[model samples]
Target chain A: MKTTFSLALAGMLLSTTAALADTTITIESWRNDDLTVWQQKIIPAFEKEHPDIKVKFVPSAPTEYNAALNSKLDAGTAGDLITCRPFDASLALFKKGQLADLSDMKIMSNFSDVAKAAWQTDDAKHTFCVPMASVIHGFIYNKDAFKDVGIDAAPKTVDEFYADLDKIKKDGSYTPLDMGTHDQWEAATMGYENIGPTYWDGEKGRKAVIAGTEKLTDPQFVEPFKQLVKWTDYMGDGYKAQTYPDSQNLFTLGRAAIYPAGSWEISVFEKQADFKMGAFPPPVQKAGDQCYISDQPDHALGLNAASKHKDAAMTFLKWVGSQEFAQIYGNALPGFFPLTKEKVTIKDPLANEFLSWRQSCKPTMRYTYQILSRGTPNLENALWAASANVMNKTETPEQAAEELQKGLASWYEPQQK
Target chain B: MAQDRKPVRWHVGVFLAPAVIVYTAIMIVPLFATLDLSLYEVRDKVAAFVGLGNFAKLFGDPNWSGQFWNALWNNTWFFVVNMAVQNPIGIGLAALLSSNRLRFAAAYRTAIFVPTILSFVIVGFVWKLILSPLWGIAPDLLKSVGLRHWFAPWLGDPHTALTTIALISVWQFIGIPMMLIYAALLSIPEEVIEAAEMDGITGMSQFWRIKLPLILPSIGIISILTFVGNFNAFDLIYVAQGALAGPDFSTDILGTFLYRTFFGFQLQLGDPNMGATIATVMFAIILVGVCVYLFGIQRRLRRYQF
Candidate 1:
């Protein structure tokens, strides 16, 4: 009896020691292709230095990522670290006391002016999400395709843009544009995000409108609508039937001349063999419209409130935002063009040019439909899904616009009161 | 029998307790809760009972109404496609594979069923890769067949997108009907077949006239199963086309619509109340289908001794 009791006591002590040794923190981020880097570089560096901490990184698959994050959040145990888009639910999650205020995490000092401002909340006091990366995604046209049609560059005015598109269509070796609407996010790119600079006129006015200082149907938005339709006309027969990536490939492999894509794709395109792709901002329209880039924090990381290992989670977040981590990612194999101020030398020439263009832009906002449309709950559902109807000619652009406004009215009118 | 069983209400309560508790907690309670949510409007991030307000917006508001109808119509077509294409194909395959002395029958069954074991996301991704014009096997296969012209990017084409996805779904689930009908066919004995032969029936006519009648019950079961599965389908569509079901929402189903509404994607804000309303709509739809089968169809199809 004595021996058995002693053995039991010894086992208990050993288990307790083991438990103490592992300060496991599950950190959630969208899946990174550089997972081996995380394991080899970040995990070891942090774990060895911290000694008392062990971090378990759980990456969400593309399809499972957001929904899984929200469900985990609702369950009150979404790991110690969570990955979420900067949106109403995440904002609400912050407001509902489910997230830690990382306001004091000295990581704020390293952020660039625009990056910091983009992440700042309504009050501008708390940063609910630590910035992972940001990109200025806008319309990109192929230079070679444009040159073949005897156009030197993408037009800077609405009239010239239309004339150029007409010329390209007349030449007709390939389509000038691919509407590729099968992927819903691509529909969002064409239907909504692309319209920002043209419609709202500029950065300051656009920000004001999203802040509810401007009406949904400002006179400024109409011309852009016309310009938007003109771009659609450049698409070949059955334009709405194609997927976004398909459209990109067509432009890349010399099938189509123009693809309205974001800067995130520059790195990917640079790797394509035998094809030299170049991008400039969407053409200016109606005299005042300069090029526009939608500047949403592509994805952000949040600290889970209910994590058992909060300290370790915070440590991981700090590491992810550090200059060293940024350097590793920025210089990785098939690397990233980080939206950070880490100043890592970009190896891809295309990425360097795109980043330079994004940096020099005088006017921009963190995307409108993604930000402004959130005034109505599940507004993207109606707006993005409504694009299908628009393509089928079942719903007119005016009808799509009205549906968007009505969704907002229903959602926000009550809340406003 | 001895004393009228004393009409034991207490015994009835004891017997019913476990099931009632389980059902209430799992299904009934959640259903009522979701319905209650539909009646309430979200206020200041909290819910207040608003009484048919959500439904009014859904039906009366143009934006909400259009989507509600679009998803409803799309969902209906999905079911129709399954019934028209999936059911007949399943029935045919089951009939063919159920024949006596079919060598490698088990191997064929396992091979055909392998897709059903895969998660919907996996199935969607694999099919997306296979169908993708970029790296998909379809374009190459077409080129190899001297019919490369036929490859016009099936998945990206809105006209063909939903049909393609439906066919993929059918490919995955054809096994369900195959298994059930195969079981039912196996149960109809050699003695019965011999007796039918004695009655001047044989071969193909024997299958159509005699064997098929005996398997009517299994067919009914398969139909109802298809209805429920079709109504609840979401993951594959969501994977192939994000929540928006793009190329113009041609593939948008009730499940994807509900998911989009409940868990806002991109710029959309999520509304749990409306999500619940959609869920309630789906429940009512499934319930009607089951009821139609139980009350209307099942009653007329009399069970046979064979």
Candidate 2:
């Protein structure tokens, strides 16, 4: 191993003395204790294998990850291999031609079919990205909490869901639903991005909107907002007081009987001392129980298009594609669900159930707020404001919908000018 | 002519040259380049001159007008909270601790100053978690008293989000101006204070009449600095809230708005042209603020050298 390692390094370093010596391979990898541990222990093995190449790690916090990466790209100092989020912003970068296409890499064939479809352009000849891990976000319920309230399991219809929530409250549970409108977008995230399109974009509704045949003021959009208000109202008074983590914490601590959130958060609840938490598909409508569940491609990654060291970059990305490495990585990552054929055995039965249950879902549609909703920055800002406004009653759902259409008209009309 | 030749102002220019070059290259050039970039439209990898179009869109166009006004309004409130809360608190602490009789004053100053040393990201997350209902010490502290009911998740609430963040910022930054004003307050000649004491002006009276007059310039300087730093600030709000400034964007300031516009989040493409326009507007806002302080406020206030 040393002979193989030393030879590779010695060749890379000596073969290109001055020119290649300066060509340092910079990797803008994420900072995770587990991932860092792997980088520290395993990367040196790769480095030892290739001596001429020296790796410089530019570690950034998760919050600063996108901004820092953007600054680096703007300055043209962005490194060879960078982590990519699956959000619409990444698509914006792809349009800018900033991302490297590694479609030709044999390792790409190993990607999950869903993962491949999400990252690649319509022309399968190009693949601009890969994923960190498969992130599964769906509605999760506490089975024990339900049983205590005399409900056996999750409801298949919207009516049964509300009935179960009522039962929980009737049983003297403080709050049946932990819908935290304190973060306004959480309401829309649950009401719209995760579910609205499930029905809105479905056969009858989408055509109406697309044909300009349906005003957003039409009951289609208004009904969801009203539904959201009702669901939120069930949380009792002082609803404005709830925060995201606060609601999640309440459910985990058993202060609340039920919660709606992403499956990615299962590991966080599992750390609680008591009670079992499990995942379920989004609540179905009694009128349309036969509709499909909305889903999206989760936690994806991509390579930099302008990377100087494509071979080494390809090697690293290739490792990410391997099911064995992905399984090892995902198991250690806690909340992540790897999309490889080889399953990493999860310790939490609830988390395992979520991963297994998700196989049947048909993703509703893919439009993160930042991307799909309103395209203009100012309009996006308004739409976001409207979410909070609806909760506060400062703006009605009809007003909110009008504001969005007006926002689009403002941008579109001006661009025409 | 040879004998009349001036000595080549040797060391000053020589010493200044490197710094001047570096500063001009790093700061001034980039600043002006950004301003110049504001006047152009991007197409086919080339920038075509578009006189005041970006500015027109930012200020005049209805599409952008609301967001611009909202951000401006939020930014104004964000700065006002700091001036009202951070500056006065800092000044008071500096004045109190400057008294020679105060015991363990050095320790107090260090303890107060330590938060300033933390990065914004750290402070944002630390305060966010601390104020959290889960794993937070703030709730427990409040619960210890009868005030547990008042323990709302401040950071996550839209109505209170920006104001809550402003206070956290003040807590982190109070040390900077505290140390500045403390030094200014300490440098006042002892003879002047002694005279005031002899004249029967003492304690609170002496501070108001004697100490504050002398430290007016320092206050003005700290004010301008707070204005500049607050106006330019992005990290604190950004970390506590995502780029979207969640909970309905109740916390969108010029900095975040500028960032989202320039960098393009979600579906929005990063428009260097528009970003430059936002930056120029910021520069104008900051310039007006500094000018008002220097020419207007400072001129009106008499700095008594007693």
Candidate 3:
């Protein structure tokens, strides 16, 4: 009995020493597709830098992530690092003290104010998450189909865009626009928001609307819906029932000429498309007009307030905000551009093409994301239906705009007045 | 005589204890808790008692009331579709299967009842794939029958989406009513049918006059079950059309609306108080329906001992 007790005491001492040497911290994320990338490339690089801090990436399905994370946080069983969805979702967590304030961290200096804006409090006094990546919105077109239609250059203006689409329709070989209304989000995200930025003049119009200086019924907002309605003729037959995947498949199969896309589609399109693909920013209203792109911050990383291994998690986050980490992640995931201000060279040509638009066009996030969607009858969801209905010819752009404005006015104090 | 009163029946309490405890824990407690939760509202992230404020908002606020009424209307249509199409078809199939002249009756029953055993996810996905305009077999199959122009994207059209989904649900759940009514039809004593035949009632007339009347009690039970089931339905619509029940929320039923409100969807935060209000309303609806069936309908239906 004495020998057994002595052995057990020695085992406990060894385990404690091991624990002191190494702290294993887990990260919770919704990006299940990035599991292999995290496991094979990212984790190894981080582990090589800090051997004392072992990292684990645990992911749930994207749709279930918010619910699962909320429940886990409530149960006090969440991981050390939590992947943050931009804007109000993460802001709500920070407000609840579930996410640690990262303002004091030296790594917070790496990102621009615009990059960090998503995970900050309304007053911008407290920053919560380390901004990671942003997806730029534009058009990804099949070069072969464009050649077949005899359109040598990407459209620089809305009129040129319609002309090119008409040429493609006349060619009778490929569908001009490859988006669908079935999923609803694509109608708003890729259809309206993609081209809407140019009409709204990017951040200028976006902030004005938020400040109640501009209404959705304003011509700038309504024009995007009008442009979206014009897409119906180019969408070919049975586009109403076409799902996101169907649209993707149609483009990759070389059946469609142009795809309204977020930059996130770059890697997938690169893998799937046999034809050469090219991207262009949203067309301007007229020649010499400044263009704009929806450069939305998609994801971030934050330290869990209840985490036991704060030091290890902070160390990991600091690395995530580093120039080296930016280079690696930017190259590793082509479409998901690193949000850091550091100049990271993109290896993928299509992604680089998408990145180049940042030089010419003003960048703005999706308008409905930040503070407008907090009330009943969420503006973002309302936009999904409105965008689809306009395309379906069920509701005119004027009516859709009026309805959205009225709904916003009902609850939002700024819009009410 | 007072001294001879029955001793305490400890075994009776023991026999009932487990079921009573389990039911109370799972069902009765949550039901009451949901009702209680509906009376509260979240203010500055703290749940404060607001009495009937949530109900008032649900019925009074334009945004909330519009969604509530739309969902209620859609749910009513969904139930109506099942009652009009599924139950009648189920009865017809059950009648045919119960007929003595029918061959391969067991095979037909198994084949027809197979869909009820499948998961909602599988059924929803398969139907979606089959009906898809881009890659689905629906258009091609129609073309082969020389009716190519007749085929449209039914599931994607706002006007047809709800009805199409309702029909798909009918296809899945028809087996349930069929099996129930089949059993009810089988349990009827053979002598009653012989007596009906002797009285000159035959064929369709015989079924209408004797079998259907005899099975009225079973039919009543099925109607109540369907009402409760339809009002509570969520899975099939969720799996098929998503949380928004797209094509302009044309297919948004009460269950899906409640789910979106309680759990939140996309960018919207979940309002548990509003969710609870919707749930409480749903419970009340189902309760009133069941009560009406019990007191008004079921009581009127004659149950034959034979």
Candidate 4:
């Protein structure tokens, strides 16, 4: 009996040592849709490279992620690896010391300043998260619908774009523009931000607005709203009540001509759209003008400050920044273009078309994402309402711009002065 | 001597302890904590006592005050819609069901009450689909009836969105008041009803002159319940219109406002201080409403003992 007890204790100690040898780190994410991709491909690849470090991808619904993660962090139960949102949301966590400073990490060298800007401090001194991927905004059109409407090529200028819309509208079968104001964010994101870059001259106007040299009421910003108002003329009947999914269905069902799209829609559209789909960057105001696109950095990964397995988590993050991880993640999620300095070949054709825009057009982040939205009457939320109102014909472009300017000037110090 | 003395009755305390402890832990503690939190603001990540400064900001600041007042006005309208439309319809349904002449009363009651048990997510999503122009049957159904023109995008229009949502909510909760009033009508002792019948109070007059007064207390209770529920309503609007309560925030009520402030929406970060302040204001409004019902109206109501 004594010999058996000693042998059992020894075995238990050996098993404990074996478990400790392989550090298991979990990743908290909002992308529940990507669970299978992480489990089947990404995790296995990482584990093979680092046999001693095990990885787990745990995800909650996107809508509840922020609240859920915050409570977990507070309770000291957050995962070792944290999937970060692009801007102020992650910055807040870093400020509270819930996320570790990854500025000194060797993997930080893999990304450019533009890619890291989303996760960096306002002063751009310390970086907290490793850049993962970005989604480019443009217009996706049904090729068959375009053909039926007697249009052969994507429009090159704003006037030409409207002319195509007019042709599509005149055709009587297809809705010219497949978009809606019911989910207000789309009105701002895929509607305003998608085209506003062309008018604002991309980063030039975006930076100017942040610097307080140019107000939202400026012509550069108001022009986009004016353009959005024009889009209402081509939208289908009852477009006012149509939702995001409704618009997607309308486009994919080949009933609509063009869809103002984010590159993220590529995977879904590829699967759903039976007809050949083509993408075009936002048309410039005139032919031969310099084009701009809103290539917003959307998601990234970071080390949780309270993590027990910091070294193992760092190893995973380092692998995440590698060319191998980018290729796999970029291909697995076609629309999510990896933000690495190293070149990556995209597998999806629609995504490739979106990526091709980067060659000709200048890339800029969404204007309100950074410091401009930190104050009351949050600029991002205001833009959503304003954009929706503009599209609904409830607010004129000038009025919308003035409201935004007034709201910004209320608390934003530079704007006030 | 022992037999003459009163028992210690320690068992009574034991019996009450579970409920008292649970209630205090879940309800009382959170209520006081929320009130306490309302008095402080977080600056530089540290919570400091601000002593109603947040309230001042909520009221005095144009930005905060604008949203607060808008939400408050919308909440009042939601309650008013429930009082005006839901309760009357409920009473009518109950009166019809209580009459022995009506057949399959149980089936009708069950059918009407079915929506009350459905989750808000299902109700919101189902209604959205039903009303959608792209896939919804609303337009087709209306067209079949030659009333297609009447089917505007009510959910999408800022002018009609709030009323549409309120009506949907009324549709779901009408059964509550109906069941309550039904039970009240059934409890009217047969002798009292018979006495009214012999006095030549029959048909509609019998309902108004005899039965209505007796159920006045139940009606009052239903009104207060509707008021409380409407003021606290959030899920339907959130699930339908989203956190911004958009199309120019026409559907925003105090509940959504508090949620957005507390949890933040999209790129906006949550501010617990402002959230607590808004919550306290809601608490005060609810308290005042309940107080008026209890002291002003409920006190004056005559409870019939037939």
Q: What TM-score would every model get versus the actual structure?
A: 0.79, 0.81, 0.96, 0.96
RMSD of 4: 2.8
A22-111: candidate 4 lDDT, tens digit per residue: 789999999887888889989998888778788999999776688678778878999999999988889999999999999998878889
Superposed by TM-score, candidate 3 places the C-alpha of residue A171 at a distance from the truth, in angstroms, of 1.7
User: Candidate 4 residues B1-306, lDDT tens each?
Assistant: 989999899999999999999999999999999999999998998999999899999999999999999999999998999899999999999999999999999999999999999999999999999999888999999999999999988889999999999999999998999999999999999998899889888999999998999999999999999988989999999999888897799999999999989878777888877998999999999999999999999999988765
Q: Which window of ten consecutive residues has the lowest lDDT sum in model 4 chain B?
A: B264-273
Comparing only chain B with the true structure, the TM-scores of all models are 0.94, 0.93, 0.98, 0.97
Q: Which stretches of candidate 3 lie over 4 Å from their true place?
A: A1-13, A20-24, A50-54, B1-3
RMSD of each: 6.1, 5.6, 2.8, 2.8
Q: Model 1: which docking level applies?
A: acceptable
Is model 2 an incorrect, acceptable, medium or high docking prediction?
acceptable
Model 1 TM: 0.79
Task: Give Cα distance to truth, residue B209, candidate 3, Å.
Answer: 1.7
TM-score of 3: 0.96
Question: What TM-score number comes out for model 4?
Answer: 0.96
Tell me how far the alpha carbon of residue B153 in candidate 1 is from the true structure, in angstroms, after superposition. 5.3
